[model samples]
Target: MSTTPPPDISFEQDALGRLILIAPGGTRHVNVHPAKMFPLTEKDHWISIQSENSREILCVEDPQTLPEPSRSLLLGALARRDFVPIIQVIHRIVRMADGHQWHVTTDRGDTTFEVETDESIQNLGHGRLVIVDRRNTRYLIPSVPSLDRVSKRKLEHYY
Candidate 1:
């Protein structure tokens, strides 16, 4: 793809390190955030850039379709935004009166979190799962079968 900025659209960073969008008609949108339309399935496609008020400013079909710095900036923004930790192993799960406390090892490191209900655990099919904790932090289990026998056994109780 060309490194040149698309004919009239461009993206840049502001002094405060926020993504700034320079629209086709020379309009500038500041503090614009990028959100994946289909975050789990089509991560690289259909990204929506929104304003501080959460209004859609632009829809990028593919980051690669964008020009130069804009593409790189958008991808970096998405990476920082979609910061889900991948759960590598389940160390323990303690049931409480209110919720279940999960102790696990993730790609980042080991941590414990509280899962309020079974609904917090979502099955994405293809052996994938996403567990949302009480704090609303999402942890990804890329493949259920890939887990160790003990980890799988611990998780079996939930699903």
Candidate 2:
């Protein structure tokens, strides 16, 4: 028999009435209001959570920006069993030409892995971007509209 403890599990209800699940070594933020559960799989440190309603899968590359409420819920769930949080912030997105090869940089370190893409490269969006860190950790990033106008040149010339 193995002595390793089982993964942690917790659930939260979002504004949209979806129940999200946060598990050890992985996070599953689901829209369960529609009574659907999507299976998320992790391979080599990369985690992909599929959407049952739209057939869309979200790939997370960072966990630090994860909202406080979600993180708190996840931490609470993990703490139930005496395990500590191991996931951290995401560094950057690793762009690849081939669909199979990919990499993600995180505060912990850089992790390389493979994922089967259903379509061509897609943009995260303009409002909030969800990312998964090196440990299959999940987080969200705010993409405020005003940020689009801000540039490195603007900051450098501000003085």
Which candidate tops lDDT? 1
Q: Each prediction's Cα RMSD?
A: 3.7, 15.6
Pick by TM-score: which candidate is best? Answer: 1
On a 0 to 100 scale, what is the lDDT of residue 146 in model 1?
98
Residue 49, model 2: lDDT of 31
What is the RMSD of candidate 2? 15.6
Residue pairs in candidate 1 whose N, alpha carbon or C atoms collide under 3 angstroms: none
Worst 10 residues of 1 by lDDT: 1-10
Supply candidate 2's per-residue lDDT for 11.
Answer: 48
lDDT of each: 0.87, 0.36
- Candidate 2 per-residue lDDT, tens place, 23-108, comes to 45575757522111211222122223334464434433322234667545433433342311221333333445644433443344
Cα displacement (Å) at residue 134, model 1: 1.0
